[model samples]
Every structure is written in C-alpha cells, then in structure tokens.
Target chain A: MPAQSSPPRTDSRPGGRSARVRAAVHQAVKELLTDEAGDALTIPVIAARAGVHATTVYRRWGSVGELLADVATSRFSGDVVVPDTGSLREDLERYAYDLAKDLSDPDTLALVRAIVGTGGEGAGVCRMERQRQLEAIIEREQGRGNQVPTIERAIEALLAPLYYRAVFTDQALSPEWARTLVSHLLPR
Target chain B: MPAQSSPPRTDSRPGGRSARVRAAVHQAVKELLTDEAGDALTIPVIAARAGVHATTVYRRWGSVGELLADVATSRFSGDVVVPDTGSLREDLERYAYDLAKDLSDPDTLALVRAIVGTGGEGAGVCRMERQRQLEAIIEREQGRGNQVPTIERAIEALLAPLYYRAVFTDQALSPEWARTLVSHLLPR
Candidate 1:
C-alpha cells in the first residue's frame, strides 16, 4: 500500500474544490484502512475522518462499493515489487512469507476484501498486476533453463493458501504455512 | 450443499415456537441464496419470504453476517458427494469438473461470499467438512498403493481457485480451468 499524500488546503474553497475533497476522502480511507482499528467503513465515519460533510461523500460516491472501486484503482495499479532471490523457489518462498505477514494485518485483509467486494476495476487491476508479476518471474526462470511450476500451479501454491486461510478460516496466516506451501510446490 | 427440506407448516404457530421460527428463517435463507437472481439479502426481504416478523429476524440474526454464519452452518455441515473412480487422479478430475459447474452458479457464489464475509463458525465448518472428505479420498488412494497430494495441497489445487476467481475476478470458472488444476496436481 502507498502512503497518503497531504494536499494543500489553500486551494480548498468549499464550492469548487472537488479535487481537495477527493484527496481528503481518499486520505481518510487510506489512513483508516491502514489502522483497521476503527469502526466500520460507513460513509459517516469516513466523512467525519476526512473533515468533509457526509452529503459531499454521498453525492460524490453514492455507495461504499463505488468508493472502494476508486480506491483499489488508484492504489493497486501494479504488483508490489518482488524480491529477486537467486532461485525461483527461494523467490517464491520469500514472496509467500511477506504476503503471509501482509495478510495477517487487519487493514490489509479489509482492503483486500473491500477490493474483492467491489468486483470492479479494482479487482481487475489486482488480478492483472499479479499475473504480470508472475509472468516476469517465470520469464527469468526460463532464461536460467530451470524447471518451473506453471503460472496456474504457482498461483495455487503461492497465493491461494494465504487468501483461503485469511478469508475462510480463523487460523493464523503464519510463516510456517508459507514455508509449507512453497515446499509443496517444489517438493525437493 | 444440502437439498432444501420442506418442513410441515403445522408447527408454525407464530408464538412460543423458537424451533419453528429458526427453521423458517433457515429455510428462507436457503431459498433466497439458491436464487441470488432475486434481490439482496436483507432482514426485511428474508423475513417476508420466511413468513416470520422482520423484528424476529433482526432480533435473532442481528445482521447479514450473523445470518450467513447460521446458514452456512446449517447448509454445509458435510462435503457435497464426490464422484468415484478407480484412479485418484481421475476421481479428482471428475470432482473438480463437478465443482466447477457448482461454483459457476450465481447462488453458490453468493453463498460463498456470505460465508467468507461472516468469517465465523460457518467458515470453520466449511473447512473441516472438506478436510474430512479429502481424508476419506486419500485413505482410499493409499489403500491402492497410490500417492496423493496432501490435504493442504489438494485444497490449494482443487478448492482455492474456485474461491479465488469467484471472490477476486470476473473470470468464469470453466471446466477447462478445472481440468488444468487437476492436471497440474497429477500431471501425466
């Protein structure tokens, strides 16, 4: 996730500053989701945090789903930078471990769920970004003349466990789980 | 998923019958989820369909999350019947194709989202039931002197893609995709 940018308020005349309001609202969403320690992402709660009137939020983004779609589009246009370990398996292990930690964060989980719930451009962007990153990894491995799992197998091994445990079960998404997934994929 | 049961209406006296009220509400939830083509799952909508008072629904379930937890618990206490085959790989392939068809249902998608959104006992139940079924399959395979993917790997291969696609993308869960996952697991 990216850090929130603070915009100048001097250009913030109430009647004509849609950009300022948008920034404030987006910033508040980022901040609140970063913590995940707040109340539900109700419009009133978000509007209060943004220091904007609730009506403004309602008018600009009619529903929480629309707002989440915008957030996902703005924030997750590409995959997170992948670690370049010497080997594909090591790289996958490191990526899975990092993802495990990210999935453990309440805010991260909520952000993902909201993105998925929107089922809009945000989710599409997320899927495409992941595919691009996976392709890059596979290309590098093929260049090395190494056997590699197909992208679909890699997806099942690397991404699915973290998400399935996070979304469907109360079990902790642990580094051990990450290790187990990589081991299953490579089976060395 | 279990088939819907039609309980006798004589037990529904509108007073002093918590069991009857619970059954009605559960039945209504099942019916509505089966036809996610209808409308959103809301207290008033469910209550009207169940022939129970809206206040009763609200008082019992409190929210969609709570209601969904109960529905999942009631509906998915056991795994759906798996097709039998002499070869473990063949069995898995058939099961994955069948599951692909089931997951393609709009109602199944909604039910899964609701269960995940609830993130309560229902999810726990879903996980455990699948584990039991997978274990049964593995025992049969071991008896035949055949190797099997661990339950964890099996889950990542067979179940996770259905969910990952349903929750995270607009892609159809095609039979081809199902075959790919099974082939990746037990490549010939």
Candidate 2:
C-alpha cells in the first residue's frame, strides 16, 4: 500500500484547538504573573509568552483583568476536588477546609480578588463549579438516606462565610471554623 | 498698643487643613471617576482637580487604586446608617436590604470592586465600620432583653450571603432574600 499521510486539518471544535489556545494563554499568564510584577503585565507580553498573536489574545480575553479572572477561575476549577468521604458532614468539612487552605495561598487569593475585582464572567464559572460539586455531595447523601440542607442553604451557611472572610476580612480560616460551618449546616 | 494679629499657622490637626485636603482629594476622585473613564484617572489628574500638588496625592494615596479604596470606604462610612427598629430581625433585615440597594449602584459597586482588586487597607476600614454597626445593633437587641445571635454569627448568616451574591453571583438581592437571611439568623 502507498504511504498514507493525514492532511493537516484545522480543528475548530470547542475542545480541540480552542481549548488548547485557552490552556496556552492561561499558562502564559500564570508564568508571567509569577515572573514579573502585576504592573508589568499586559496583553502583548502575555501573547508573546504564549506564542499567540496579541490581537487574538485581546479579542479572546478583552482586558488583562478579564484574562486574570479567567486564569484564576480555571485554576480553581481544576484544583478543587470534591470529597466523597461518604458522610455529608465530613465531606463538607473536608471540602471547606481544603477550600480555605487553597484560598489562603497568596497567588490564589490574588486571583480570587482579581476575579471579584474585575466583576467579569468568571465568578459565575467559579460558582457553577462549586455548585456542581455540592450537588454531587448532596446527591450522594440523598442516596444514603440522610437529610441534607438545600443547595442554597449550604451555599449561604457554608460557602459564603469562607469566601467572605477570605476576601473582606483579615480573619484566619481554620479547620475548626470549617467544621463549625459544616455542623451548622448539617445540624442534628 | 499695636494691633495684635495672629500668625498664620499651618493647620495640621487631624480634622483641620489635613482633613480638608483629604476630603478635597477624595471628592476630586469621586468626580473624576464619575466624569471620566477609570483608565484616564491618574494621580496628576486627580491632584489637578483637587487643587493639590500631584506629589502630595502620590505621597499620601500612593496610587489610584488606594485613592479609589479610600473614596469608597469613606463613602460607605458616611452613607450607612444602622437601624434601630426595636427588633433585631427588623433591624437586620432593614440594614441588609439597604446595604443590598446601596451595593447595587454601579458606582458603588465599581468602588467596592476596586477596593478588593487593589487588596489595599480599605478592606480593614470597611470591615471595621460594618463591625461597629453590627455591634450597635447587637447592643440594642441585648438592651431589649432579646436573645440575639453573636456578632460573628450575624456576620456569617446575614451579611455574608448578601455580599457573596453581590460580588460573586448573578443572584438578585431582594428584600425577601434579606428577610430570609435575617429569619435564619434570628429564629422566632
């Protein structure tokens, strides 16, 4: 048989070239943020680092604030792993503690602050990721015949305080605080 | 005797010319923010508007972000009035609803976002102001012989959700939502 060579195809699927571009751009932003002061960050610098055209970066991200929000939200989405500890209280406490720890990181906190500061669309994405994780935990609890609070209640009572402290206050987020919040949410 | 004329003294007291200068600078920032795009705001422009030296503005405020944070915090401090409705639930609900309404203003929200984005000292000032208001409400409830949740609990149950939704979610902050949060915090 003659040598069969596949032609170079333009992959425009959502998870194909588009996803790759986003990953590269996000990675470039992270590297740049780490290597340089935030004041030194700009679209052209990021585009150069990512090996993408500055116009493409600008068209996709709009501004440095929006781009930072996207990168931060994506980092949260990837880093968070919802626990399946089988007990709802334990699961929530673990999740909350992990979230508190993650948010305590300076870089992560900066990203979160950027997301809120930018008031961009990334906040919704971050909220949805947390909602999905909570829903999974709630579904598991339901299957186990345990009474659970509504997702809205869980969000208000459990998630809100953690983020509130992280963003607005100088209060420390401890494991005990996470446990207390979970206890209040899943009261006996 | 020759007419005794008082010497011109530099008013450096806390609420004297120093305070006047600060007020003028903050007012200039507010007017500039309202009149121009945030990108066009700079120390020199703000100082020029305030009729102060650019070096003075720079030395005091450090950057536009800090200046915006100061303006926003001072605005909140001056604007917020803690309710005394003779009932804890009513007071909390009214306060929260008002807060939601105030935060809904585009300019106020932008100022808040800037404060968080800047990660400056203004967050501490804002938190302290809210804490003082909460303490007043708590003391009033205590004087009435009503069993009230602790200030920490009130913050977690009542205040956090409003800000959480305002900053992070697309959820509407309705009077009913505020009432619900109050009810949760102070159950009958």
The best candidate in terms of lDDT: 2
List, residue by residue over A78-177, the lDDT tens digit for candidate 2.
6678899878888898888887887787777767765676666767765677778888888899989978788898999877998889889888898888
Q: Where in model 1 is the C-alpha error above 4 Å?
A: A1-9, A12-20, A23-55, A73-79, A118-121, A143-148, B1-52, B77-79, B143-146
lDDT of each prediction vs. the true structure?
Answer: 0.72, 0.78
How would you encode candidate 1's per-residue C-alpha lDDT over A1-188 as one tens digit per residue? 87558875666576558877888998888787665343345688789999999999989988665787777666656447876887888888787887788778776666666555433455565456656676678778988998887887787777776777777767788888788888878898
Model-by-model DockQ, in order = 0.34, 0.49
> Model 2, residue A48: displacement in angstroms?
7.3
lDDT of 1 at A152: 70
State what share of the real interface contacts each candidate retains: 0.39, 0.67
Q: CA lDDT of B10 in candidate 2?
A: 72
Interface RMSD of candidate 2, in Å, is 2.5
lDDT of 2 by residue, B16-110 (tens): 88788899998886676555343435678889999999999988877776787678667878577889888777888888888778767777766
